[model samples]
Target: MITYIEELTDQEREAIREAIQLLYRQTYLLERRYDRRTEKYQYTKEYRTCSTHLEFLKDYFAVAGISLEENVHDGIIYIQGETLWGEKLPRLATVYLLILKLIYDEQMAQAASSTRIVATAGEINQKAGAFRVIKSIPSPTEMRRTIALLKKYQIVEPLDILEELNENTRMIIYPTVNLVLSGDHIRELLESFSEEENSGEETAIQNTIEDLSE
Candidate 1:
């Protein structure tokens, strides 16, 4: 529960709004599954629009020296350009990673390979904490961005799994996206980030002073 919000300029808030909107959109578009037994979807079902999620993002970012501000038209949000908290959208990334973790857990339980199962994004969101899954899964664009970020940090990598097709002209193969996570490594990264975030208040104060002077 870190709170990163502070007053922000129109320009900075707009950037934040756009980024969060992108995140919500991307998370919503991920592939998912349906459980006939439950008569409903399993992964993520539905989530708030970008604006709704902004409330939480603003709080999270505020703890890290980044505040959100709305544009004059109130159609956009702005954020500090710097990586105020060392990581961007930490909550969102953590949520996506948690989804991957859940998928891994399910695979292990079923004794199936990653490529052998189909998971719906809806299910993931449902199981996630409100703080994490503010909105449903991200859209494709957001997923791509998340993937890029994960790859950039080497926190996760695309895993290749073998798929097979039967000769009966029936589809028998599941094309699941593979995810790899080194818990120890990821834990270390989070710990370091937490440490950095502890000093976010000081940073925000300094940034505010700079803003005023400018």
Candidate 2:
């Protein structure tokens, strides 16, 4: 690996280093991320860097028992492993994630071309109320913090200032939502909520966040 890297140009080496650090921080890197300022998707340089050094990255992450994978069809690159470092999401964040996954699925089913989906803060609250996932709507401060956390990990991107988030504020739900929880897991959790509702009980969704980091 050293010999191969030594043969690369200085710029390539620096890019590879940056790519490594980026993966460590975010776990997943999309080839194209939504740019609110441009109102379009733009190619990510880190993704290109990772693609250029795929083999080296695979070998490097292997030492830590993390498996680096790329989905060309979806333009996503991610790492997964039991040894991965992760964050313990707050209950509200976990609930929001579940709602986002549902929204993504619903949008994808109706989408004709683009996979990029958009949703509003009001819509999220509506879903939460419909599902009875939480007893009441989250305060603006709670919503801001939750969105910021998910944005940091590339799960969602705000279309407006987070501080001013309200029912009408918009956000771009990234495809990375699919990686956060499998379809089966999502169904299971939703079913559990349904059963609890039927039984006149409340249940909180439990997530270890083992697959998400930083």
Candidate 3:
């Protein structure tokens, strides 16, 4: 390992440093991965760095319990660390993550391709409604705050400004959302949410009735 690290040229070493930092910070590298759009715009030269040295990165990160995953088919390069902060995600964010995954899976089932899954804020809200999860959608400010948390991990990326959000406010829901939470786990959350939503609605209705009686 020492010999291999020594063999790396200054440029290669720099690329490794940037890639490691990117994965450590973002958890997923989408814009950095090679894709059709990456080629069309002819992005900055940093984007041109080939993944030929990825194997070295994999071996190196393993020392720190991080696994560098490269999926050309999915057009993503991400890392999975043993001590990742998956358990710290808030329940609200988890529900949103599951909803996004459900949306992505539904879309993928209908059409299979490398193309990104686009979901509008309305669509996510609708899906949450359909699943009978999240008794009430929080105010846009609170909702965006929750989403911003997931955004830090590169789970759901916004395509437009927060002001433009509505039924038509589209965002690219990354596959990493699924990686963070497994398929079976999401299904379980759905069932749990169903019960919670029902209870919450019943309580709200009873409170309203009591107010009317007074």
TM-score of each: 0.27, 0.83, 0.70
Model 1, residue 54: what's the lDDT? 60
Clashes of each: 31, 0, 0
The superposed Cα distance between candidate 3 and the true structure at residue 199, in angstroms, equals 13
Which 10-residue window of candidate 3 scores lowest in summed lDDT?
Answer: 204-213
- The weakest ten consecutive residues by lDDT in model 2 span 205-214
C-alpha lDDT values of all predictions: 0.39, 0.77, 0.61
Tell me the deviation in Å of residue 62 in model 3. Answer: 2.5
- Residue-by-residue lDDT tens digits, candidate 1, 1-214: 2233346656655665655554332211112333345644344222223344567776766776666654422123345535532233344555555455555556657874434333444444454534333434455555556554543433333322112211111111111212123242332333233322433232121122122112
Error of 2 at 95 (Å): 0.8
Candidate 3 backbone collisions, by pair: none
Off by over 4 Å in 3: 3-14, 31-50, 194-214
Tens digit of per-residue lDDT, candidate 3, span 1-214: 7798689899887887776666665565654322234333222232234266677778887888988776766556667764653234555665677688888888888886656677888888777877777667657876777667766666776776666455676677876655555444455556566634434232110011122112
Highest lDDT: give the candidate number: 2
| Total colliding residue pairs, candidate 2 | 0
Tell me the spans in candidate 1 whose CA falls farther than 4 Å from its real position: 1-89, 112-122, 129-132, 136-140, 151-214
Residue 148 shift from truth in candidate 3, angstroms: 3.3
Displacement of residue 207 (Cα, Å) in model 1 is: 30
